[model samples]
Target: MMFHYYAVLAIAALSCSSTRFGVVNAQIVGQFSLEFTAVFKPAGIAQKLFTELSDPETSILQGSILSTSGLIYDPNNVAIKEVAGQFAGGVQPFLNPPDISADGTIDGQCTATSVNEEEGKILAHSCFFNICAIEADDCINFYSGSPFVYAPALDQNQLPPSYPGTIIGGTGVFEGIEGSVEVITVAGREFTSQTSSSGDIAQRIFLNTNFEFLERRKI
Candidate 1:
């Protein structure tokens, strides 16, 4: 059988600087919703790491992981807007587990690109994320930077949950551009995982995101 989970999550805003544009100069907010499901499929110790239990039934450990999602999409409209990506990096407190407390965190980098095969234009970016579990059911995440950073400063460029993230740089038309997005609405569920016949038990993460483009302009 297949397992699925849906959670309502709150999203953080992002920022980027530009002499030609300002957040206040934003004249319109374009809203878009994004949803996607991901899985953890690993070999050797990884499969055991994400699927095993610690002494307290739930514990987090210090290790690194690499995971990828299937396909993400924009719903309702007949036309499809999609993207696919993955995350990989280190986790805190290996002796203890993956998601246990507010201190349990994941520091990683991600790469996502829009897949609008029909239009022949694929927009993709490379960025970093810092996610910290707040409680048993909540976690705060920060994402920042882009592919153009020359070097990836995963730790230094992180954007916090309370603040909007800025666009440092990007691919294609987003190059040298600065902008911040507003959270229209965000909601998700408790993190859950399930085992499969293939020995790969992936956690189910269902997220619904609606955000408005607060600022988008060339520098």
Candidate 2:
């Protein structure tokens, strides 16, 4: 099967929970400034549809859904704790290095697993683990596992000049792409600034959104 890779446009902030697959509320948080293109299954009449959708004048709406299958990782490990905290909650106040997993890779006995498909061209997967750590205040907190993208790939022409070749797997699905095509925008505040006392923030998140079209053959 020919898979057309799309770029990872934005990171959506999901609600905190102990469940495996995080929930994606229908809200845009941040904007995606990157630029690129993705082409999937370009054949015969499909080519015309692709051209129309890819056109600059055309407007594309991006959305996503959570995967069913989840992965496994070390929840008790420090690295796992940090990632769990970051994925579940943003950087903690007055906590430098705040146990945030800056790097998107799995850590501490984490493994990726694929879930059974529910519909056509739709697959479910996730990465799960836990974290237990002691704080400076002599307090102990335990964090459960969280889900993230497992298979991220870049489609042809989706990467920009600076980012050449396709990058498969990362925070976002497509490594390259341009212009807020699909993005997660914070609703009430900016990513760098805090607007609420509870530290309630927002992000424009995309989940399992894909596009495919056929290309016309020149005879």
Candidate 3:
């Protein structure tokens, strides 16, 4: 009975101490930047047909998957290579009548490795002129877990020809760390025909990015 009483008291004390420690440790915040380039090479393509509306309505949907490979360069001169598989689908909605403007949304995901073999998924609500973003931008977030766990609060966008992106938060080794990036893109839509390679109707983009990182003072 005496031993049982002491054990119960000891366990309660430890639990209270742990709770207090957690409360004392505050989360950190910061911002930084990085840079690199990602090349998305189309591997296959597919067109989604709307049977009910056989006659041209006001939009068309097309999608494809690409083997993405790239290297990310940081402001501190760190090189991070990424080999990823990305799949995306988008619909080119027509204007009031039937004007095909490059205003649409593309949503997809990519699996790559940097700090670890993490498959980061993203849904970018963006606009583009053919394969290039013209005077528009997008915001995307990424989460990585496996060897290490982290989240790159993403902002992938383009201001006309080039743009900037940033990371707002993270976890584990990347906890309290934030980063930023600059982007310059070269798309196949400008270089190659709209449809090519055995009528696959492919599209590719070379995304060049630069980054920098900073750790917060707390946590």
Candidate 4:
């Protein structure tokens, strides 16, 4: 069965000077959106880890990991635009020319901390995305709070629900940046085995007038 997920996340940033938590008043807000396909296919436990529970009723226990890597795209293209139309929210495809990529790569990592079998959801911790520009060496990083709900797919053709995240900081051109981000899982698949899982995802990044960006060095 092929699982799919559709996300329309918004990410925005404000340039800052301090590390972790310092705010500078700059009137300029950097905003943009990028689309990407995410795949979760880990080769082994070293890259992906799962904790098995004795409860046979439990499909997913606490302390499982979600890791994936894929390509980033500029949503302005016709191919992605057509795909966006198939989702629920009649979301328009767009591209922010200055900071992000026309096409690039993305890597994500998140770990489950709590499980809700009754609701079919898991609370994940330290979720983040590292997106890089194609051909360029610069990459921007976005992170989630200590915990966020990881919703499961509704059917055999969809992925878990998308969640909110923050732009902690970045490297090279994206250094000392701050912003708000909404990650849309445009497409994805559940990792159901000891070997691998796969999916496709898209992200829309925009700046928030009320908040400031957090700074952290690239990993």
Top model number, lDDT: 4
lDDT of 3 at 99: 31
TM-score of each: 0.24, 0.16, 0.28, 0.54
Give the per-residue lDDT digits (tens) of candidate 1, residues 56-113: 5532222213233221111211121122211111111111123311122223333433
What lDDT would candidate 3 get against the real structure?
0.24
Taking the tens digit of each residue's C-alpha lDDT, what string does model 4 give over 55-80? 55445546667666765443433132
**Tens digits of per-residue lDDT for model 3 on 87-149?**
111111112222322221222332222322133322221221111112223222332222212
Q: Candidate 3: worst 10 consecutive residues by lDDT?
A: 15-24
lDDT of each: 0.25, 0.20, 0.24, 0.46
Better of 3 and 4 by TM-score: 4
Candidate 1, run of 10 with poorest lDDT: 87-96
Give candidate 1 regions above 4 Å deviation.
1-59, 63-66, 77-164, 181-219
Q: How many backbone clashes does candidate 3 have?
A: 13
Q: Answer with 1 or 3, whichever has the higher TM-score.
A: 3
